[model samples]
Target: MTAPVTASRGRVPASATAGRGPLGGASLPTWLAAAAAGMCAAAGWLRVLPGTRMALLLALAATAPLLLAAASRLLRRTASTRDTRPDGGPRPPTAPPPAPAPVSRSVPASTPVLMPVPLTLGLSLAVAAPVAAAGFWGSPARFAQAAAAAVDGWAHLLATTVPAGPAPLLATGPFLLVWVAAAITGELLARTTRAAWAVVTPAAVVFAASCALAGGTAYAVTAAAAFTLGGVLLLRARARDLRGPVPVATRPARVARVARAGAAAVAALAVAAVVVPHLPARPRVDPRDHVTVPDTPLTGVNPLDRVSPWLSTPDTELFRVTGDGPLPQRLALVALDAYDGRTWTSTARYRPAGSGVPHAPSGGRRLTVEVTVAGLGGVALPAVERPVRLDGPATLAVDPDTGLLLDTGGLAPGLRYTMTSLLPAPPQPADVDAAPRDPAPATALPPGVPAEIDALARTAIGGETRPGAQARLLAAHLWARVRNDPGSAPGHGYGRLAAVAATGVGGAEQIAALYAVAARGLGLPVRLIVGFTVPEGANGLVRSGDVAVWPQVRLGGLGWVSFGPTAQAAPGWQAAPAPTAAPLPSTPPRVVPGAGVPTPGDRLASDGPLPVRRPDWPLIALIAAAVLATAWLSPRVGRAVRRRRRRSRPVPADRIAAAFQEVVDTAARAGSPVAASATVRQALDRVDTAIDRRRPPDNDFAPRQADLHVLRELTERAVYGARPLTTAEADDAWARADRLRRRLRRPAPLRRRRP
Candidate 1:
């Protein structure tokens, strides 16, 4: 070998390749690295927003040809550079050897690098096919409307004439055909250029951003963070590659140090962002909002035994009675002998009979009562004294003083408790007593006792002589003469009883109280009964367990008769001749007083039916769990079935070789300068070598041989005579190969397989 080329210092020129950069040029790697970085960033972003990710993915899929074109451009550029000498002149070809057999290089693993574009485009189309079909056939108008709504500024630009009827071929048919054509073209370009990542990255980024925006801030933040982290990891990987080789010991130590530093930084940031702001002082909540004190007293461990007039309203319902038997004449809760301004307290401490239950009175007609109760404030079922017998399922106790049944456990809704109320028949006049000493507290006359009240009481009973008759006469007069006008008197005034008695007018409670005070003051054995009044036309009743106050006075040994002095004294009392007429020899018959017809007091006592029980939580939970399980399993099963089908069918060989050739040609066109004598396998091998040499092909010339395996196999079968090829098979092979070539020339990532 003659004289060797030498450098200026007299050293041989080594190999003319000594000063060349990796891959023979600087621009290709720079561009490819930039494109790869951009693609990585875009893919990261796509993971953040679902809708945007879907849309971009669809668009990328539709434009596969463009990606292939880019890959081909890259390959061509790369090849051109490789073919030229360092000084820029084309290298001289060596003389051909005589009688040489046709030779082909085996395909290399790296050939897939040039296939990104066409592969991405094909995948994009495959992915979007179903969506496109849905949009085309199933309510195209609705689909367009939804898309328009999702795209904020472009709504007006959207076409409104959706393919409605079937006859006009010009409508959806042509549009769909064009769309399919565009998609096919894009796929072909992608296969040829292998620049799939270039096409896919932007679409992915846009899609991710859109999804993030649509999902709201919480979702957006999480998505953005995840994408950012992925991008950082990619960057780190690229950086590591750029750093070149290092001593094994030093490399391990450096990697460990970096990892530790990164971990500490992450920990510190997490603590700062999430853990330090909730430790400040706060004000205490008010005690009144937490608890309520019980103002009424109880007996026999029943909370409902006590009745406070202050808390009682005239119309509040206490119970409801429903049965074939007549309703008990009077639903009495408790009897109070003493009165303060707001409440009635018993004058004497109760003395329980032998078993703590009040003993029945000696003689009286017994009446049965069935009661249902609701609400949560009480635990007692009220009834008159001397009940013959109690039935139904419920725990019963008695108030020692009032001799009323105190139901210990709160009444359940729809509960039916029975009681026999003993009503004494009207006693003979001779059997009645004149008067009895009062055991109750002395009445306290507040300032301004009305003069008329005393004079009226005196006038009505003065001539009667007998204490019992006098009490009855006075009650009858007041009930017949006074009007029950809530506004007839000045503000419920300071002297409540005195004022009401003087004016002969007041609210139901005030008037009732006056009647009680006046009757008791007359020396009759009178007791104040606090309970609700039943009104007319009340269809249903809700037993709130609330008690309303009224008065009950004894007529000698004849027993108590329940009546509302306030109601009788009201202005409308005489509008309808008393519900019953006085017994007269001349008159035939009249509605009996206090018989079948419900009084105003009774209506007030019954409101509406009560509920049975609380809702069941376990049944609801079980149903929810079943629904979730079904939802979770459906998609997985579908995917598995599809995968099985794909595995069962293998691709033909000629198609594989054809696809390989397409990728090689696309790469060459893209400036990657793959060897002409190289078979698809050889080209793949060269790509692998290039990658191992840390010189990735240009983005446009990225290989896609992995995706084109089926096409390559088919091509090999056709060329090597492994199998007979039909015209359709040849066409398919060419088409697939062409598509793969375009994809290899593009700058985007290869697309995923379609479902």
Candidate 2:
């Protein structure tokens, strides 16, 4: 027969007769469930996806009722056992309770089977549909591309199977598989073992998904959803078991315990997912254009000579010059009198008839040239008729025969050379009357010369009296009228000089060649000066090797006079009288320099290489201080996190019972009837059951049997049992107890039915 229980002053008193059992010391699962739910909510606030949020909520909701029930049952069982004691003092230790009988098919059931299936399917569809739509409709190609790119990116991260398409799918597919598998596995484990598989299953799924989705889209959300769903199902199953035979009476306390554990697990997994994959050591980038410039000079290598059929046509720049002074008229380099299809050689070997010293005419002037030479292939420099001296560190030697500079080392930047050129007075008509006779080699023509040359020449010079006058008149007329269009057809090559003379229009090289041929035909000496022309403001003049082609006509007494028919030289020349004061001793042949020159210590005073400036120490100190401050704060944040986690841990079932008893004691002290020996779970369940029955369970003896059942199971499993309760089971028990407690505490008409 059951022993009779008593109450005192409308309050239930703590029992002293209860023996120590596993259930007596167990923590409630409710606190853990609540904690997990709270963590999920926080993750949602931090921008975790909706699917994840729903999954977590479902898990919490599904297991909450069960957890609360277990907590309530545990409290009741504890109180009843205590009340059976003979005295109020601590009871002697008793033998451990007998092992529960194996669950049989005959046992009555209260909950429905297969509750999670519908929910799981609905959630899966909801998550997948939108993703599918995005991939198929919004932009299939872009989706594919993004996926492919993401996969390729991750290929650098993980040793994964190569997918045919985008990379996101690789991670996404694996994530889905792992998540589903984990969920099923967790549910089965919970059903078979009554162990909380919620935390482990979800955590494992999340970890695997995170690894796959390190750089993938929606990874965090997917991982969270998978974990939450699996955990919730497992917890729900555990909660059901807790509510079955053994019941806890401390509903309120157990609820709190389950809530804390759930919250901690959720928070930890979320943080782990976010933090782990972001560690460095990412893939190396390979850019398309990554050619390294060669350090050695490129001489004798004509970049334009080998025209590869496989390569695109080359781009040729019509000379560019930069300098400080007004743009120049015409800057000549070398003269070419002979040409094959590929080469242009000078008429004959150069032979200097005079001393090596250049002789500028009486009206000569000094012009400083800072030439930056580039792209000259076997070509020679064509300076003014006479260049007195060159001043630059460049190792360019003068070819005495051709009066040109030769440097096999090839042209480079920052070349500075000073030249004193003879500024000859403009020629008068009488000067043209005495044209010079053709020189030996100048009169000889290349074999390919076109037949139309003689006729075209005769027609061009017919009106002029003298050969010199004729050549000048023709040159002047051609320059004014001929349009310089380099894009035109080759027009009979250099051999068709006569055809060019007739047309009176051609490219720069063509016109220059024609002039040479015409002048030669007229029995006058002329040379085809194939050299680059420089405009004023041209800087960095090194050796004369930089010039392109032009034409030069020999005057009877005066040497060759440079004339550019394609691009006329700058005008306005006033011949200066010979200097009376013996020209300032040639500037003592100073060691003028070009690029790559190392200035001596004394020369550092002049404009030398710029120095690398160092930053002020004060600024550096401030930056250092800021870094230190940040470092100092980081550990504080870490400590705060640890404290929060500790607080979030599942509350012990006894503590929950104590809290419930305290509430009851306070109420009892206020003149309400109370039982003489009662557990927290029993009081809470009695109160809820009494309300449900629409009748108070004798004031202090309020029935909370349902709640006690939940609490007792959670307490026994968590405290005395070796296996820890799962997040799902703890959550369910907590939720049920909370609802029952709230109802029991209600003022009036809304009381619930008692068991």
Candidate 3:
């Protein structure tokens, strides 16, 4: 009571389906299986995709199969309704058959015509849970944001930091194409083929690529294999339901086909396992390295070099800090002493400084500052004046002279560090004169110093002999003229001369650099300090706007003392008394020397020794050959082991079935007439006929043919005889079958055997 069979056709006709409802509608399980396959494939991509945008990827992947299924159903319905009569008129309709009488017994209520919404939602949630968990584990906040913008965040949230390469589209293009094809192809193939293996092909390919690209981790490979097995099981079950039952005569052939399919699948996985590990790992570039330069002149630590678009966003919290008492007005990032005419950077060597905390100055107090960084992104760790001790997960390196923190890594979000520093005392005239002798390197000027800069310095100092007096005069002069406006700042090409020519109209960076350069031009030691200024408010919310810069001049005994030269100079610096003549320089001031070389112990430590590598071609070849050989032979070995296991089973009929299957598979592989649709009797006859048809048959072929015929009879008896098959008889049949198989595989005689 089934639709007409098409010989050797693997699948049941659509009209003879078992699980379909009375109206021939698609079954719910079929739909769910397809959706699950798509969902698992999407989940597999989580291990390879770069960002916390799993919600969007999963939503797209899960819905694709459903959409394809709906489209397929619509196309089938349209095809069924179409009239195919050659004439321009519709064919005449036949009389309808009589309706069957209804039974009195109760039946289950019919499902609605529409797809089940709750079931679909439940399946989607099930698929989305693992992806969500993974995203949360990696980055909770970013994942939440991506989920919130699932409908429209693809462009902004789903991206890697790597730049577009030669084939930019290949990265995402192949993944999407494979996803859509898998959904549509799997749905169509499910109906045309008995097994759903074809439906999962695209998904398998994608999963393999993902594993290879993700460095072939054990977890990734295992997950992909498990999902593939699940898809195979689901497909096989649906195919079985559609096909109904297998006849006893054909069971042996079916088992052989299943074995072949399994071997093929195992071979594919073995090959992937052997090859994927040797593939190169993916490379990614950090987006933070490509900072743009500002259009206007810069001063403090070359502030324009660190300018970022994110910092310009209003109301964004940058960082937060807490200290024991009042915080210093400024927190230095680094001190720049080497000016390259165009920019200022640290070029001095650094030595290891101990972590032990240092005592505060005579009148200053010791306090600890805890900093919690937010949106800022840089390698520098900002701390109060003269950090003595740092405590954090990251290793800390400091410049002994400037006390600037060395670059460790990017300042990631949510980073917290504690710094213990000494509060620096306000600069005083007596303190400046009491400082030790200043180093000549601090006053060295770059080559080709413009006459305009020299004239401006000479005019600002006006014959002042004291170091502190000259510094104050130049600072006040620059502060009076600079407006801190971009339009009024000097343009590029002339260095500090341009700023002096423009009447010092620039921002903190330009003015600070102007003061440092002018002080150095007058044979005074000075350096630039770039840092953040603490506002009067105690909220402790530091925004990008709070960034500032100033100059620190070297004194006789007090060391380097800070002085603000911008229009926004702190009140303390402006109120400091002018330098006195008491502790004058050991010798009179000299003319500015050419830029001096940076001595050792000025910056961060040097890199360690690199490791050596030598490639061994012979060893590499041997390893590759071993992997390839194992992958190639694994399936055959597995098939042999399975056959041996079946032979040892207690059931006699199972042994007969396994032995007979081996004969049919071997004959088919040898290109003999052992058709899959043939019965056991027909297959035996075909084997005999094939032996006779061979030109000059082997001398032992006649005896092998007789043995094969006897074994076939035993197999038929075991399958259909009234009496049960005995263990002794099954063993005898197995022995004869193995002998005949070996003879059939033997080489034919070349001559008439010495006739």
**Best model number under lDDT:** 3
State the lDDT of candidate 3 residue by residue for 124-199, as single tens digits: 4343433343443344333343344333322221222111111112123333433454455434433333345665
Score each candidate by Cα lDDT: 0.41, 0.40, 0.52
Candidate number with the higher TM-score (1 or 2): 1
Order candidates by TM-score, high to low.
Answer: 3, 1, 2
Give residue 475's lDDT in candidate 3 (0 to 100).
65
Q: Give the backbone clash total of model 1.
A: 147
**Could you give the candidate ranking by lDDT, starting with the highest?**
3, 1, 2
RMSD (Cα, Å) of candidate 1? 28.8
RMSD, one per candidate, in order: 28.8, 29.1, 17.7
Q: Candidate 1 residues 1-755, lDDT tens each?
A: 11111111122222222212222112233334333433333333222212343335433433332344445556654664465678988789978633211122232222333435456545544434444435444543344533333343122111111111121111222222223433443333223223333323443454353342223334344545554454454344333332222323233335654665476447544543442222222222322123332222444422213333323333445567654554443455555666544434444222211121222343455566576664423554556444545554424444433556554455666666666655544332233335333333344433443565567678767767675455545655655655555334332233765666665556555556666666655655555665433333343252332234565555422345344443322222332213421111111122233332112121111111111234344654554465467446644554344323322223433233333443453454444545333344445555443332332356623344443454545544544453566656656665655555444434532331110
Worst 10 residues of 2 by lDDT: 599-608
Q: Compare candidates 2 and 3 on lDDT and give the better one.
A: 3
